[model samples]
Target: MAMKHFTIQDAATMYGVKEWGYGFFGINSKGHLEVYPTRDENLSCDIHEVVTHLHKKGIRTPVTLRFPQILATRVTELNEAFHKAMKEYDYEGDYQGVFPVKTNQIKEVVDHIVKAGYKYRYGLEAGSKAELMIALSMNLHAEALVTCNGYKDESFIRIALLALKAGRNVLITVEKMTELPLILKVAKELKVEPLLGLRMKLNAMGSGKWESSAGDHAKFGLNTQEILDTVDTLERRGLLDSVQELHYHIGSQITDIRKIKAAIKEATRVYAKLVKRGVPLKYLNVGGGLGVDYDGSRTTFHSSMNYTMEEYAADVVYTTKDICTQEQVPVPNLLSESGRAIVAYHQVLVVDVIGLIDTTHTKYRVELSGQEPQILKELAYTRDNISVKNFAEMYHDAITQKDELITLFNLGYLGLDDRAKGEILFWEVCRKLSRILSYKSLKYIPEEFQDLNKSLADKLIANFSLFQSMPDHWAIDQLFPVMPIHRLKEKPTLSATLCDITCDSDGKVEKFIDLKDVRDEIPLHEPKSGEPYYLAFFLVGAYQDTLAMRHNLFGSVNEAHVIVNEDEDFRIQQIVPAQTTDDVLKSVHYDPDELVEGPTRRRKISANSDANEALKTALTEQRKLHTYLEMN
Candidate 1:
């Protein structure tokens, strides 16, 4: 037998980097994961170096690494794809995109998007009052559109009206007919003609998890009759001229391009009908459904998209052009709130493997003094006779004998020693079955042993909390690509499942993304004691940060903003430290001052000896420390 050696290319293929990374991520010859900011550049930045630098600077494990260069690149790729599509189709109107702030409301994330997307005049889309305030604070380009979406109140409408009066291209989309009067009233009070848009509830729906964002029974948007009634009300008031944009969102993370094309055709027809009624709609806002291929399978799965950005843009442009030309209406300006597509690749959640738990650590062989139970002897025989050729039959026999051994022990016929031997023998059989299943030449694993890998996988306890980092995986079963950041040049011989540091039983990631299907476990190398092994969850920039919860009082992890230099080296622009114990207490309406003062007073009253004083000092230091576990 010969030991097979694996290369960096094998790591790339195993992790689906070429498909999901979109050329920004790869492994270098040094076995470190590298970030290539630009496709034309030959230079690369090692992600391991970034982590090492952060560690040197006192930033611990479970730090999020933000690559602003990737954000800029994605924004450029999205806009350029549309621009190329418009040119090829000879489309009359231009393409405009606004990032929905709800996808990631972090100030740094929004700032990076605004900075990177300036060339494309990319703007912000606010779905709430708080989000609108953030959007209004940004100094967007003069031509950039500020889209005000979601359910609005009087204050929301007033703010939108003020933004419009301030010469911003603000579009207040009416989700329901009830919102139209609020816009009109706010506009009349401010004596400013507001830019109004209607979000139509299209009959055509999108595909994937969020397809409910549109369709007849959607949560937002006005029905056909409600839209007509609103239009008539505006027309009677001579305010139909204010209706300058038509908006419709099929869903978020739409995986199928055909669904996008169908939605575009339907929305364009709605735009043409509105124009025929003398509404003079100039903007057709195709609300965001642009998806990222998280699994990199290129299939129409919930986790991955079937089409490319260029294909999406081409279909959007050509469909709108064809529909408008048939209806003899002008090609309206195209606007998309593609938040997920723009930000999904901009951040990676890095966590270190603190330790591994091996389930098959116990030796199975037992010393029998010729007085062992018949059932225990049979289980031992099955374990000894287990081989690849007869693993299935031997496993079944072991299971039956183990069950009989447990029954005999409960009936007082077998002693604890015999029962222990039986259990060990069963686990040894499982271990041998898993080893046989791992043969490289094996094509298909039997259904009975399909879960053998999961059973034998090493449970890697990670330092990060799943609730605070990847909420989608916990809440919606979303798959994020997780891979080792280093040791790519070596072969990963162990299958592992990641268990977070949280106390909740649900705080573990067992499902992983694969090229052809979902993987039950991730391939990982055997951890060397006293050495740090790091893994990263990729394409988590969208909806993760904002959606993270404070489960078990675990707050936000430390964040490192990495900027790529001209020489392709990296620099940490900023580091946001994780929340302290006081921060978590304050969030839950606890007074930190009162807590500290009470603890101090109690310590003083109870401190009569040197040991008590030392305990008080230790308690004070513990109170100031962060909530997460500190790795030794």
Candidate 2:
């Protein structure tokens, strides 16, 4: 039989992977995010080398690279997809999307989004007064919409009205019934009537962690009674004409397609009712629930969505068109605040794999002398005699002996050497027992021993921090697609958990994406000699970068923007260095000037004793390095 040779594309194109490559993302020929590369020639740029270069330049541990080209491609694809759907459905409505600033508020990211979307007039969504200011300041085209959401006070409403006063197309969405009165009061006091939108509390609920964010009893939005009161108040004040848009967010990462149809129908009815009451509504704001398949599963999992982008667009347009036409209402513009879907695929967080623990090291192996200890003999027996039929009984006996050995060693009944031998033998036995049990019965395997798969498991030390860079994963158990940047040709031999360098115990990912369950880590191939190993976390552009916090004073990671130029060459632009120790201290109101003194202040005039001589030499060295003790 002849051997078949396959390139990275060919392997990635196999079976279902090819569809993900097209619909989701792939490295383009210019080393950018695209459907696939232009050709094999485009694979010349090494993502791993980028990490190594950054690490060598003192940008150690974790670093996030923002690819502006990918952001451009994402904005383009989203617009094109919805536009194509409109054409296919014979829809009369125009499609517009806004990048919710809450998803990611990084300056470079927002700048790149605006630049890429200048032709399409893609706008920004704001959930706060500050975010509205940012959106108002950045949106270049007057045709784009500046959407204001979230809880609002007088100042927040006042600023949004001011944005409208400045000729910006601002839509202030009333989240609560109370906000409506405040919004009306602010607009009347300021004498600026801005376009108004209402986020309705629909009866339909989405499925995800944020499912509770909507529905009839949602935290935000107006109920049926509240909606009627709002309409009455508007009619009385002659401001009903300002109610131009109806918005509803079932949830973020809505996995169920049926929920989409239901929510749109519910929201569409609300729009129709408002229209029936003489409130002219011209827009349907389907607030940001278009989910991404984070787990690559076409299932209704919280981390994954069941429907495709085309299906999602079709549902939104078809449902709205049907409801509006049936009610004899004009077709409204379709607006989506799909922050996650828009920005998720636009960025990849590439972090290097520092090192791994070799579980098979000889130092961890057991070598028993004559008259072996009871725990060692039991371990040997467990390793040699434990089978699927007797695994449970042997495991119990081994555990008992293990506890006894540890207790004896702590109480000085056993020697240090014996304790070491006992632990090694017990671990060897546990590994073998786990292997035997996994085949016939894995249910009995303890959670602590679940890492003992037959395949060699390597602990991967990632450069990124869970608390600092990927807080959502640490906080909400959100799973992102992670894979090696290179070495696609090699089969991975090890599966291990990723441990971040944070002092918090919750800073590790124990669950990773697997066939049956979300796992803590994926299998990784061993590194070739002198070659740096790296893995990239995909679909992290939204919310992860800006929402990251500095835990344990670890500081933030360095960031760089990667752009694919018109010549199809990749270039690094706008490198913002990470904060230094002094800089971070200054941020927290620490005055470095007050705590510092010159080296001459610490010098002793009489240095005859040995201690004085040593102190004088230490002071000289510290002065050379520009370091000083705070005590001075």
Best by TM-score: 1
Question: lDDT winner among the candidates?
Answer: 1
Residue pairs clashing in model 2 are 510-520, 511-519, 511-520, 512-519, 512-520
Per residue, candidate 2 scores C-alpha lDDT tens digits across 1-632 of: 97565445643532123333334445433323332222223433445555555666655435677666667777887888889888988998898888899988988888888888888888899998889889988956779889998998999888889879978999999888878878888888889886988878888999989988776678888888877888888888888889888888888889999999998887888788778878888889988888887777678888888898789988889999899889888778999988887677766676666667665432477656658767677777776787777777887777888898999888888898888777777767767675686685355665655555522355666666777677889889898767776666654556566766667778776766543466645666675656667777777877887777767655566776655444334557767776554555566686544334333345554445666556556644433231111110
| Residue pairs that clash (backbone atoms under 3 angstroms), model 1 | none
lDDT of each: 0.87, 0.72
Model 1: runs farther than 4 Å from truth? 41-43, 362-371, 411-417, 438-445, 566-568, 593-608
Candidate 1 positional error at 420, Å: 3.6
lDDT of 1 by residue, 1-632 (tens): 97767888888998888888888898888999988866545756889999999998889878899988788888899899999999999999998899999999999889988988888899999999999999989978999989999898999889888988988888999988778877888889999988888999999998999887678789999998998999999899988888888999998899999999899999999899889988889889998998899999999999999999899999999999999999999999999999899888889999988888766654346756667778877877887788878877888898788788888899999888777777877888888787788888788877988887788777889999999999999999999999999999998978889999888889999999998999999899888888899999999999899888999889888999998776658889999999988788889998776665565466546436666557557656866777788885
Global local distance difference test of model 2: 0.72
RMSD of each: 2.1, 5.2
